[model samples]
Target: MKFALNSNLRPLQMALLGSMTVVAVGFAGSAMAENRVTYKSAKAGTSYYQMGVELAQAMKEGTNGDVIVTLEESQGSVQNVMEAPSRKGNYVFTTPPSLVAAAENSKGAFEKKPDEKYKEIRALFPIPSLTMHFVTREDAGIKSFEDMAGKNILVGKGTFSANEGTKYLNLFGLDGKVNLANVELNNAVPALKNKQIDAFVTAGSFPSPNVIEAAASLPIHVLSMSDDQVKQTGAARAVIPANTYNGQTEEIVTTSLPVIAYTTTEMDDGTAYTLTKTFWEQRDKMAGNAPWWNGVTPEMLMNVSGKMHPGALKYYAEKGIEVPATAK
Candidate 1:
């Protein structure tokens, strides 16, 4: 082993090895930050859309723009989940276990047929629970779902929120009797203020922006759903604490569901892991801008529909969180 190295060969070998190291590191870095991705949320001005915007910004900041997320406004939860897996790297926001269950089985609003893509959607994180808001004017004389028979009612437009409204109407046996109006959340406010509709139903995280705005302008009453009503309707029980909004004194017992972020299973593990980590790291920052993000916890991230992204699972496991067995 006492051989002398060739003067010329040593420099060449050193340069070659250095170049290989640089190339390997470059490829790994590139893989860490894939190209831009589209994040689908409910129509603009909705809580989903707001969350999408903050998520996109947080992901960008965390990755230093490596993972660029574009906010894509979608129709609603059912539509968002249905359309989410249409493209790779596209993500969606869904509330309540019901919507995800419906999308996964192609039931309820998704009753056209079974979609294989639905099975491939994976949960990423839980943002907030969507609170149902049954809006009516103080003078509408509508005390409950029973009182809305034969009156014009505004359900949400092209979102799972709207589907839930219709389900409630049907559950109360007022489906055919009431004049159902499918309109956007913002537009529904005017219809209610102008007396164009007798009652309107909308939903989002507590302090629903539209509901707050509507209540500020008119003598609005957010009707309550009894525990029995929610149980009968198959909606998760929720309570809107008194004074959550101006003029709202009494607590509103209603149904609600957690909103989860999801992505297609086809996303690379590295990208998924990076995105998930970035979201967790910047969550406090995101919540500072959007209060709806304040209540996230390890428990909230568990018990989601469909499988969990392996990347996300790895992160959760590191945090000592329990993922559902089915999802794992």
Candidate 2:
């Protein structure tokens, strides 16, 4: 077909197409960078908080700021774990069984649809957490978990721990034996001093200044979980060695919140790979800045029961470990 093209129209069309391609490329690059992953921690002024700040700094230094990480200080793991994908945060300072806790209480913590109830967060690395401290008056004589049944317990109420032990204790069929008393951090110490509460379970990974101060002055006791009970709490609990707490010695055993390093499904496989990489590559810098960062290792992040994120999985696949189907 013989046709005469308008030269002016041809150049305009070419220019238009070129502009569209440039826009497309720019759009893709922006998306890649803007897909930021946030890491949240239970509370501020704690080791978990310090480690998270170190991690974001490491990401900025390692990737030259290609990955902008946000650190959202949170109430506790119970709340932080649910904030991922809500634009609240991505990674979290959580314990071994946080996902288990989320799974059991999905509707309670997450924005649940009948269809999608679980966040299924992955364990990135294990951050050593503080004691699941059962601080009690020395005269209380509450030496065992069974003994906790009938006594008044001072728990951090309307917050992360949310008296989780009460549920577990009830599960153990110890209901009615333990009187439940919930209070915030402000009144907890005074209540214990006045004998208003028999024992208090405080979860802290960093230097819990108040609790530690309380321990020093009150002549308190830290209780231990038997080996069998340790296994039963699933991923959320771990047996801390005796002497973990000051002032209370003599194999006063206790279980700690497993403080696992974590990230969300929002992070893509490649980005997750970089984060998982930075988490290890900058371990020294992080640990130097914060003691809790010392505990993280490659194996601690992977080799867990839950599935890793796709980005994390992609990183692991290089080491010849295939992520399970649930992970994808």
Candidate 3:
């Protein structure tokens, strides 16, 4: 026999059901508040991509999982900038200030696909600079840029190193006198070991993995550039401290292209502030694990191009970190 609801118990049952519904809604709302940001950087296995992975972990843990970061593979900085205009939600990417300047001016790679939306890009935080490493085989007898005049040098094709190496060779009047190896950077170490190339130019943060590998496997020398030479290249000056690699004894001065994490106006002020704040607060922690991150400092913020995201600016202002007027 079907039993009818007892009138006295009906009120208690309704109240219990209402309370349960309210608790469920609260949990759902909390879940919805979690933010997911897409981070696009270099291709897999590159230092930048690895940094993205570390940063993602730091963000998740530091925020107590309120913020989640997802890393995406990118061809290079140009491709990252190209996607910024079309990307929605909270999107972040890393690139050199020069590329941002070019994109803003619709020059170089951005010339054909220039979009007004590019103007919305904003700076978040500075990352490690792409420091140049002029690694030469010890037996090659190369001590400086001038020594590469007759040596076989491998500057990986279509990379920043290749472009800068060409410019430096021409600047020092050794253009045609040197043999530039045409090969991928992944082959540089093997090529150098096999005596196919006497030296190679690679760009990454120091201690650059490739440089460390070269220095560890064979006797190597990192060429130093004069202050005047670095100035002529028109890139940021960087110094690889002594013993950065296995056998390196003296600091090697070189040029670097500053890279920065960037986002667009689509992100809310709160989220931007959280990201910027978390980055600085957790930077030292990140550095303890990855030495490359140790290179990042508040002073590097001066290199940031475009305007700063308001949230990031807020953090800087609160922390008394001086930001460039141009980035303000």
Candidate 4:
């Protein structure tokens, strides 16, 4: 076969080739990077969810949408840390007891060895919760933990409150005396009002919303933490002064649970660094959504306990903040 092309054919071929290349580039641009990270927590409607949304919004605005964060709620604090970096979420917000347990070389707790998977986790921040308050009727004559030794106590398994409080209970030899009931707070609260359970042990923010609501209808007293008790547990605690919450004119003293909010070390350092930087830089936007993030500062992030990635260390140093004392 013989083929003949007119001189006009050369320019048309070049234009067609250019059009194909341009279309290819456009499609690649539209694919978008899959850099979204998930954050998980338990306790529906708790402050952690609010904090997570704030963080996600900060990520979007900071990178001009290059990175994103999503929240997965209602997983127990312990579960949040374990499954986060691997499956549902990359970030875990929970109490330190659980994170410390996750670090344990315990069998069957983590899917992979500490070096392979556990090392992926890092402590990003501390939320700082308070101890499980043991609230009894004021006239019950129970002014301190010593008084509740032989009474009914409420607890749920796997709660940080249960784990830590049990240790102290044993130390004082009250573990055998208290009639331990494995029940939810809701079920136990009503019973306490009816003289069923002497006191309920629960870990929550000071002026527990449940305790506050219960007090509006009935009278109750939150047991005070003795200096000896605080020293024994060795966990950071705070006091809920009298009138800290509505309905109680007198101080409702309690101790802090002291928790940490963490992320997995498994994520690429660049991803971790960007997240750490963007969250702090755009913290005002985050604080708008969840006032809980309000107290955080750039200097605060530099002082966290767990391992920090090299990239995160670099960003902190550039901001005139020193690297964490133990950063590698």
lDDT of each: 0.78, 0.63, 0.91, 0.63
lDDT of 1: 0.78
> Per-residue CA lDDT of candidate 2, range 1-328, in tens?
2344666577888999999999999999887775466576757876567667777788888887788878777886656555544543355445455454455355454436222423556656556555566677788888777778678887666644445555557655677877778666667778888888888767665335556677766877777667676666653444444444466456544445555666655545566688777766787876676654554445444335456666666666677654445545
User: What is the lDDT for 54 in model 4?
Assistant: 63
Q: What's the TM-score of each model vs. the native?
A: 0.76, 0.65, 0.95, 0.72
Worst 10 residues of 4 by lDDT: 294-303
- Between candidates 3 and 4, the TM-score winner: 3
Better of 1 and 3 by TM-score: 3
**lDDT for 190 (candidate 3):** 89
Q: Roughly what TM-score does model 2 have, to 2 decimal places?
A: 0.65
In order, how many clashes per candidate? 0, 13, 0, 15
State which candidate has the highest lDDT.
3
When summed lDDT is taken over every stretch of 10 residues in candidate 2, the lowest stretch is 109-118
Minimum summed lDDT over a 10-residue window in model 1 is located at 88-97
Best candidate, TM-score-wise? 3
Q: Per-residue lDDT tens digits of candidate 1, residues 1-328? A: 3345566578899999999999999999888656677777677876778878888889888988888888877766666766755765545455455667887887887788568778888888887787778899888898888888888898866555687888888887886999887556668888889998887887788778888888888998888987788889776677777887789889999887777888887787777778778888998997787766765656776548778889999998888788888888
